[model samples]
Target: MDMRTPLGRVRGLGSTNDGVKHWWMQRLTGMALIPLTLWFVYSAVQMSEASHAEFTVWVGTQGNPVLLILLIICMFHHGQLGLQVVVEDYIPSESTKMTLLIAIKFAAIVFGTSAVFAVLRLTVGSS
Candidate 1:
């Protein structure tokens, strides 16, 4: 069967939707994290002399909430992306690849949600 037509090899059947938005979002989030991560590291270093109670108080403070939330979101987003890449690279069979992808996504969602809930509980309960 001839795969090419006068239009030249399915050239007219381009993607019905674009994925540039998703690519842009991933890059934007990554860019946002650079400064956020540096701020977090600096904040942590500044708190090195703090006692355990003081450290807890610092984490529960209003100033830290935005950073903490960003950290949580970025950590999970990066994790999910990494796992997906791994699955795509290593898994040979299509069925197994899909199963692993779903599993990874489920685990990421569960872990991220639990972590955020725990942070919220600590911060809110302490206040």
Candidate 2:
């Protein structure tokens, strides 16, 4: 039973387009997160008893900043993708959905940028 209207057919939404791209991205981020998260957990455990200065020095080490930045980006982006899916599935009102989605994206961008900036500052500032 086709539930779409003539306009929907013209619109070419749902799985007809865009969905595959979103699905791919979501999966890719998830996969990326696996190793990144494991690395983070291992690093944290390795640094469990370290002092703040030691942690700061560790963050400033070569490659650590880049890895931390990548972690921040992937984590935030993956979270935003999941939130978007939930909003799309649960939210019924179009206007409300769009607003929430926009807000979520904006928040993610803001927080991601802030985190990256903090990492860069800490890693570079003390150098």
Candidate 3:
């Protein structure tokens, strides 16, 4: 038996089919960020008083560059997913929603790439 309410039937709204995947990705990235953020805070506090060269040297240390890149990727992706949900939930206009989603994705890519490149450059230069 068809169980959709009259309003649901009229609007023709239904599952997007990818909501579970989206939810899983968001949760996984959030879980990954927990330890990453803790490490970042601890490192920041440890190096709070270090000189510029010392900071660069730390960034170049074994596994530090990789962790930093992972941090950048996860942070930007998490933020993009969050903003996408807000836009989709609050914005009523389809065109505006699509535009904002594109912008969010673009900004995430640009900023994330820039962060990763900066870390790589520092790592290379420190050697």
Candidate 4:
């Protein structure tokens, strides 16, 4: 029951069935960023003249830490997804593409974790 075309057979190209999930996640994260980004900008402006202790206290306040963590997660995840699409589309070498994708994911996790940890420390230490 071979249905693949000659060219497809030659190239061994086939669907991995993962594109839809990736696409949906990219769109969802992008949509989520809009409000989160606005909130972050508004908060930044509001806290522009805040002292260090005041800023820490603000972070420790109700909902602020949670919002900050969500912002970090969505920001890093969205960036990683966009970068993966770009890398997959443009990069011709499989090895290079795989290496880059791995690096991107790893960096995103490390940086995102550090950002969240910093926020948690601020919230906890301030309390």
Candidate 5:
């Protein structure tokens, strides 16, 4: 009494409903990283001679804060996805795997959120 469609069963794509979503997220984050990383590197290179005050002022600019936030988010998201794949693949125990995945996700969120908050502080005001 297989519930899967004939083709699904044949292709070994049975009802693991999250497969497509996981794959898509990985690719999407990877794509987002390209431009973000390029911009970051370019900005860093161009700012190589900048003093601390200049950098802080630059961070307070209009779009730089948003770009920094997005960069932090996409970087962490991409890293979390890759680490999840590794844990899923290499970790043997189901309990351990689930624990590691949850920890990875939690850490990513915490770190990413704090980073965005820090950027906001830099961009908004000195206090």
Candidate 6:
């Protein structure tokens, strides 16, 4: 007696092409973040002992705008990827996983936008 159904035997078995995209995106974002995060941390540490006026002046520089934007982008992208992996690994129900993923994406968008806006307001308003 054959153990497999005719349909199962004939159907091609493999991924639907999602795995490679997800992996590549994760690694790409991670690589982009390394330099951005290092610069952020270094700037933060440099500002650790700065007075208010000094700190504001430092951030008012042109380089700071690009750094701040990079930080915001990297932060949200990393957050989204991390949350996705968590949801995929732990959430068993399809409905729940989908809901959580959507929620995470929106939350990341809202928070990231707000953060960038706040940074811009501070930097632009100061000068």
Q: Model 2 TM-score?
A: 0.82
Candidate 6 residue lDDT tens string, 1-127: 8899988886654322256677787788799889999988989999999998887777777799778887898889888988888888899897998899999999999999998887787787555
lDDT by candidate, in order shown: 0.76, 0.88, 0.89, 0.89, 0.86, 0.82
In candidate 1, what are the lDDT values of residues 15-61, reduced to their tens digit? 31234654565677788789888988999898989997887788887
lDDT of 5 by residue, 1-127 (tens): 7787877766744322467787898899899999999999999997899998898887877788888899999999999989988987899897898899899999999999999998888777584
Off by over 4 Å in 3: 1-17, 125-127
Highest-TM-score candidate: 2
As a whole number from 0 to 100, the lDDT of residue 114 in candidate 1 is: 88
Q: What is the lDDT of residue 101 in candidate 3?
A: 89
Which residue segments of model 5 deviate by more than 4 Å? 1-17, 46-51
lDDT of 4: 0.89
TM-score to native of every candidate shown: 0.71, 0.82, 0.82, 0.81, 0.79, 0.75
**Pick by lDDT: 3 or 5, better one:** 3
* Candidate 6 off by > 4 Å: 1-17, 49-52
Candidate 3, TM-score vs. the true structure?
0.82
Clashing pairs in 1: none
Q: Which candidate do you rate higher for lDDT, 3 or 6?
A: 3
Give stretches of model 4 more than 4 Å off.
Answer: 1-17, 125-127
Reference-based lDDT, residue 24, model 1: 68
> Which scores higher on lDDT, 1 or 5?
5
Query: Model 5: how far is 32 from its true place, Å?
Result: 1.2
